[model samples]
Each structure stands twice: as structure tokens, then as C-alpha cells.
Target: MAATGVSANRLELLQIADAVAREKNIEKEIVIEAIEEAIQKGAKSRYGAHHDIRAKIDPKTGELALTRHVTVVEDDWRPEDELEEFNDSALVRLKDASKRDPEAFVGKEYIEELPPFEFGRVQTQMARQVVMGKVREAERERQYEEFKDRVGEIVNGTVKRVEYGNVIVDLGRGEGIMRRDQSIPREIFNIGDRIRTYIYDVRPEAKGPQVMLSRAHPGFMAKLFAQEVPEVYDGVIEIRAAARDAGSRAKMAVLSNDSSIDPVGACVGMRGSRVQAVVAELQGEKIDIIQWNNDEPTFIVNALAPAEVSKVVLDEEADRVEVVVPDEQLSLAIGRRGQNVRLASQLTGWQIDIITESQDSERRQKEFAERTQLFQDALDVDEVIAQLLVTEGFATVEDLAYVEAYEISDIEGFDEETAEELQARARDFLDRQAAEQDAKRKELGVEDGVLEVPGVTLPMAVALGEGGVKTVEDLADLATDEVRGGFEVRNGERVRVPGVLESFNLSQEDAEMLILQARVAAGWIDASELPQPEPEEAYEEGFEGEDYMAEAEQLFEGSSDAGAEAADDASDASGEEADDASAEDR
Candidate 1:
């Protein structure tokens, strides 16, 4: 830092290092090391570039020293960068050093003290750059260490400047940039204005560590509530899930561990004071404080506030829920631009499909009619008989075919002979259908061994064959995402791509089991290598959603919680294994 050609002074250099260390918020030792390096660079320029020039600064006396070092290295040792040869000036071979001193070791260094020299024009500029570069690096490291763990925390800062549409905030210890997309829509701020933001992510970059700040993140609202609601801060109440249509509306599900305290009222406060405080900070984003229910349907209903729900049907296999609302409550249930349903979906962790009662009824009737017609054609039964079978809850001809004779005979106005005749016809139709499918499957070049894979049905084989998978090996090579369906980037946008078995509505585990079984059948793996199935109880304990249902194989056998846990665990394992196996196999 001293100017070129200036006389070296002890106290001035230490004082300069102390001031720079304090200003940069770095350790004084680091500044001293940076100064030593700068002096070394200057000395190297003055002497020869080939010499190993070294410099050191005393922490207390600020005494400066310069020296040259020649290290003794083994003759056969080569540097990591093979392109560069060892320098004889800086490095001496052990063979040669041993000759100079009988007991010389490989690591022994020969040091020679040099006379002090003044910095030149080029040396001064080089020293300044070296010092600045090291100091800046230390400062960046300090900032990263200070702020990396502060993510997900709300911070108060002043608007330092704006670049394009992003705002740069001075956070006292470091700087944070709230990108345009992370800021609340329509919110405005000027230089020197105080603002609040949530630290969402911190990433180390070449320029510096990036502290990504956001006001629109749901965590920001949750933190604001924590500040305003003591119950939340004290953990008496827990915010289970939160979703935001940011700057427009948000939904937060809160639960009280204490049975006496209502979570919704606590968050809403007396006369809405608590919720209002949070809303103000969020740039007038509407907040809905809802009670969290372990039951997913109830929670989803609560999340779609001001909209009444008539019914909810959850497809555990799909992680989707079809909600039936009253005809008049359609708009309210869906919200503007489907916001209500979207937020409810996010809060419940279910894909929400909203429909009106009329639509649901129409769909039910259409399904009933389709089933009725299927029986009429397949069983050669009259419309009245098919309608009677449909009314009795026979959804498929297979149900009638396999069902006990008593089940059909017990139907009003049905005789034992009639039930038996109906079953025989149903069986014949299924046999003919299977025969047809087998013929078509053969035509498509599907191997019969594919049918031996666990869980592969006739229709599944047909579908697989149509999908260009003709053998067991082909089935084993599929990824779970390919089987359960996944997205594809098409023309710069993500589009849904259906899997071969997508229409089967198979759960992720079912797909994996299918593939794993196929792998065994194809001799790609051994059956003994398959994971032992865990009991359904394994997942039931820590299940998060309220709408846990029994395993699809079991008809409402266990509680919903128990069922979902098993499904999720299987799905996760299957998904991971499928990805790995397919990556290798393909």
C-alpha cells in the first residue's frame, strides 16, 4: 500500500493492515499475509523471476524481511502438471544436495537473506493488485461465512440501489439482491428505504456469494407471523403448510399442540390484528388462516376458503383429488385463474381437480351407461337385465363372471339358474376377448415370457406390445418415470409425456415391481435380489397427509395414514432404483 520508491516504515505498514482488516471485516493476520505476498511479488520483479522470493511481516513489531529459498526435491519427483519441468533455481535435486551435505534430506530448504529494496513503478502496481485481490478474497469468504446459515430467515435492510428490475439491499453485514421475480408484484421501493426480505438461498459465485432474498416466498409470510404471533414463535402452534399466489393471496395451515387453543384464532388475533400485521408486510397479500387437519380432504376443504365442497374423491395412486363442489360455488372453489384450487393443491400436496355437482353426476351416469352397454353387448343380455346388474354395483363383466352365484341370485327378481347362465356368458365373453388379445399380441411380436413377469396382465402386455416393448428385457429397461409418466422438454417448455402403462393408473411401486420382476424373468437380475416387502405398518406412523388410505390391494384395511406411508416409501424406492437400472441398462 505504500507508494512506489517510498521508504519502508514499520509502524505505517502495520497501521495500514489493521485499518484494512477492520474495514474489510477480516482477520488482521490475513491482511498481514496479503502484505507479505505483495512484497514477495515486488521483490521477485526486482530480483529474477526464477528465484523463490519470500517475505514475512511481524505482527507486533511490523518488521519486514525478504529471503530466497531453494528446496531440495527427489530427483525422480515430477510436478503434478507434467507439461512444466522443475526449475533448477528454486528446486535442487536430492542427489545433488546429498553430495553438498552428507546428511541432507529431501525437504531441507536453503534460505538466503536479501537486502531491502525500494518498489519500482511496475512493482508498485503489481503489489497493489496482489494486495487488493487477496483482501477482496478474504472479504468475500467472511461475507459467505456470516450469511450462509441465515437462509430462511427474515432480514431488515435498506435499499442500496436498483439494477434493472432487481433491488440491491444493504444488509449491514453484507449485501443481498432481491431479483424481480422474488419481489412482490407491484411493490415499489427507493434508495434509503427500509425493507424486509426472506433469505431463501445462498450460492457461492465467482463475483461473490449470492444471497437470494425474496418477499413472495411463503416462508417470508410464515416468519412474519412468527414475529407477530408469540404462540407461533414459542412453538405452541405450528404452521404445517403454506402456499402463496404471491402478492395476491396466500393460505397457511396451522395446528395447535394444546387442544384448548384454536390455531386459526391465534393467528387471526383479536379483530384480525395478527393476520393484518402479516398482510401489511406482504404488500396487502390476502392471508387465509386455516386449521390444519391430518385428514387431507378436510384440510383441502379448509384451504379453499369461502368455497363449499360437496364431496372429495382422492386417488392415492395418482396423488390427485377430484373435488365436487355445488354448481353455484364453482367460481369460488376454483378462485380467479384457478388460484383457490392451486393453493389448496399445494397446501394439501395433492393435485386438485375441481368440478361441479352437475358435472360429477353426469360423469357418473355416463360411466353407468357405459358399463350397462358393455354387459348388454358382451353377455348378450337385454337392457333391463344389464341395468339391473349395474344397479347392483357390478362395474365390470369380470365382476359378474367371478362373483359368487349367491351374489347375483340374491339380486331382486333374479333366479339361481339366471345367475349361473349370466356368469357362463360373461366367462365366454372374457375368454373370447383374451383369445383376441393373445392373437393381436402375437401379431405385435410380444414374447409370451413377458406375461410371466409379476403383475403383467393380458391388457398390460397388449399395451406394452403396442408401445414397442416386445420382450421381458424391454420391460425391465423402463424407468419408473417412463412407466408412471413424466414430463419432456418440448420446444423449450415442459410437456406431459405418457408412459406405456400410464393408462393403467399404476402406482410408482407397481411399475417398479413390474420392471424388477421382468428383470428377473429376463435373466438380467436374480429374484433373490428383489427387496423384501415391508409391512404396511412401516409407513403408517409418520404419514403427513390427512387423506391416507388403505393400500389399494387391501380394501380400506388400515387407516389412511398407514396406507400412504407404505405407498410413498415404495414409490420413492422404486423411483430411485428404476432410474439407476434404466440408466445402466439403456
Candidate 2:
């Protein structure tokens, strides 16, 4: 008879499959399918040649059954097949002898049944190994799917072990890997210790799901806040931005949709209880909660908490900001390694260059001193001349050099010879200043520093004197042509200023550079150059016009519709054209 306990073994195997599924958190059907495939492979290898074989186990009863394979033989081979079948196995026999083929060839194949011994001890062991492997693989796939989308979410787990500074967390379903880099420095964990972390990432590999956990990400704090704050969870309070130096400190900008609720106060809780809890969870890491702002300067001031910003100078062209703070708050605003300001820059998406009030004043003073020294050096004068000019209100190079020597003599206690000396000294100083200014302007792609020859007509000189446009530096900084109301041309050609060469003569490059700068500075002009008029006495020019027309007649006749339209258009187009034109210049 067959092995009487085969049914018992099958029932035990089914129970083992169910237990494995439960232990691995996999579906029982997966284990069942694995076992079925394993058994089919083993049976095919053991009995495929002689007969078709099938193995199956009942899901409900767990009963194992086996079947044999067969094919009908021709009538001519009937007696031979019956004899061969009887010889093939003691359990095999031809049920219909008259249907067998007597002349069946040697190569012809037939069918027969073998006992359960077909999958004997060796084959059964191989099948069991395959099934176990497949079951483990299925379990890993299930675990990966469960956790992949869970990144950035908070998860709680017990610490199973620590190896080389990494914690192995038992996350109920599987062990998640928490790398040393992911853990806050100085944090400690012991076996069976319950800890909270973020599911930072999940990656699938040949072995299993690699679930990465993080305790130090800035978002970890935000996620925890959401869990703790009902308003955040319900979307009433929104976290506008967050920056962190991981375990040491963090800053969060928050805003509220509900004006009735103060976001900062709400997040802090009464008596600092709520924020204190978050800090406690972070193991004493400091947190600063600030009000979010759309204005960069206001936002930056908030980001540099505890330090008051007196002013912000935004260089929008460079996407940079210079923040001025009180003298006492310098160290606070800069922090260690400029960490405070750096975080503020990162938080606000602007490059911040910070200076204290005293520091800025000192820097400007130093720059002015250097300019004065250069002036004295070029003029071969003593410091007294610089001091005298500075005392007499001729502080800027443009003021002293470009205004004319007569103006210097006009000051009390000044002789013509003294005035001439001062004018020469001032001109020398302008040349030096222009050289330095041009270097800076060239560096900024604003202009090429070139000095203008001292021979241009008084009108052209006055036009150039409107802020000392003799050098590329001056031109590069010109107001946009639209703002100036028209472009200035010299001799029917756009005036080009030389860039970054000491030659006093205006080259084509210099003229082009000048026209570009004039366009920028004057805030007016077209693709073509319009002749710039010589400077005349402002009062005399207007007085001559007044001589010809009465006020009412001027209002009616002189105020042309075209002129009004042009003025309005220029006003509306001023800054916009400058921005676009500057971009094109770049």
C-alpha cells in the first residue's frame, strides 16, 4: 500500500506554509503558489520521460494527490504494448489489451504511472528549498511596496541593535536601516529603545527593501510639528520655509491662513509648552519660529533672529543683499562661520553680504581715504590739499574736477593761482579716480575706463560733465535713455566711451561704450543717436523763452499734445526699459 502518513505530511507542510506567511507578513497564497511551482518542477525532472505527472494539494483539506500520463497505441502494437506495460512497472498495466499496438517502434513513446516515490527524499528536499527561497523573496517585495511611499513620514520603532553607529530599527513590518549620517550626533540608543524618526528614503535591491530612516533632517522637525499641532494638520497654519543646522539649531518661517490666529504664538503654545516639547524631542536643539514675509528684507530680518537689521540694500542686478545691523548685533547676525547669515541667505533665496553699522562706516571711510591718497599721489600735493578740498565741500572727484576752476576761486580766501593749482590737482585726481572707477566698472561689465580729452566743446563738455561722463565708468552708470528722454549723439554719431585703457582719445570702442552708458544713465534714446546740446545757463535759457510768450499763451501753444504724450510715455516706460535694456546689454 502507499505510505499511509503522506496525507499527514501534506497537512503539516500546509501548516508550515501558513506559519511562514504569518511570520514574514506575506500572503498565504504566495507561499502556496511557491510550493505548487516547486513541486511541479521536481515532479517534471523525476518522471517527465515515461509519463505525464501532476501533483496537487487541496486548499481546504490539505490532501496530496498524484496522477499518471498515458497515450493510446495502434492496434498493430496492442499485444506488444500490453506486454511492455506489464514489464514497465508493477503498478502499471494496460486496461484494454485489444487497443495496444503490437508493432510499436523502439523510438515510440508511451505512458505509465509511477508511485509517490517519483519525488523521493532527494527531490522533496530540493522542492522545499526552492519554496523557501521564493517565499522569502515574496516577503521582501511586500515589505518594499509597503514602505516606498512612506518617505518623509514619521515612524516609531524599537531599537534592535547598533552597529558602527547605525541603528537597526524594528519597524513592526521589517527592520529599517538608520545610517550614522542620518542620526543626530551625540544621540544614543539602546536595545529595545523606542524612538521616532522620518522615513527618509526607501530603495529596492536584490536582497530586500532598504528602508532608510533619518533623525536629523529639517523636515523631521516640520513633520513632528504637523503631528503635534492641530492647526498645522488642518492646514490653518502653513510652514512657509525651514532651515536647519541639524542637531544644533533650526529656524522655521510660518504663516497663518486665519488672521485671527497668530502663527508664532500658536506654534509656541501657552508658556512655550508646544515648542518646548519639539525642542525636548530634538534633545535640546534650539528652534526659532518667525513670522513669514513676502518682502525679502523683512524676511531676512526675521531669519536673523535676535539681531535687528537697520537697513537692507538690495543689489537686484546681482541678486545680492547687503544687510546693515546695529554695531552690537554684528556677531549675532554673522554667527559662527557666518552660519546665521548663511542660513538666512539659504532661507530667503538671496545672497546676503552683511555688515554692521560701524563696519560699513569704517569701510566707506577707508575707501574715501584711499581715493584721497590716490588723488594726492597723482597731483604731487600734500595731504593738506585733500584736507582743504574736503573742508571746502569739494569731497567728490566729480564735484571738484568737472565744475570748473572759476568755481574753486569763487570760494572765500582763494586766489586765482591757488584756484588754478586746486583745479589742476582736481583734474589729476579725476584721472586717477576715473582709472580706478573704470577698473571696477569693467569688472562689473558696466564700462571700459577711459579718460576724455580736455578739448571737447563747452556744450559737449557740459553734457559729459552731467556726472562726469568722460570715462567708461560714468557711461556704464548712465540712466536709461528713456529716462533721459532722448539719446545724445556727437557729430551725428553715437558717442562711444573707451573702456579700461589709459589713452585719452575716444576710440570706436570707447564711443560705443559711452553711448551704451549714456543710454543707461540718461534713460532715453533710440537705435540712432540724437545730438546732445551744449550746456547753457539754465535760468538764462528759460528767461529767453519767457521773454517771447505770456504764461497763458505758453500753456495753450507751447504745451503741444505730442509733448504731453511723449512725457507720459517716457514716465511709464522709464524703469521697465532700463531693466530690459540692461538685460540686453548683458
Q: In each prediction, how many residue pairs overlap at the backbone (N, C-alpha, C within less than 3 A)?
A: 7, 36
Which residue runs does candidate 2 get wrong by more than 4 Å? 1-13, 44-115, 118-125, 313-321, 336-339, 349-351, 366-586
Candidate 1 lDDT tens digits, 209-303 = 99999998999999999999999999999999999988999999999999999999999999999999898888789888899999888988898
Top of the candidates by lDDT: 1
User: Given candidate 2, what's the lDDT at residue 223?
Assistant: 88
Over 161-258, each residue of candidate 2 has an lDDT whose tens digit, in order, gives 99999999999988798899888879989999999989978999988889999888878999888987889989999998887777788889999999
Cα RMSDs of all predictions?
A: 8.9, 16.4
Kindly provide the TM-score of model 2 when superposed on the true structure, using C-alpha atoms: 0.57
Candidate 2 lDDT at 308 equals 87
Query: By summed lDDT, which 10 consecutive residues of candidate 1 come out lowest?
Result: 544-553
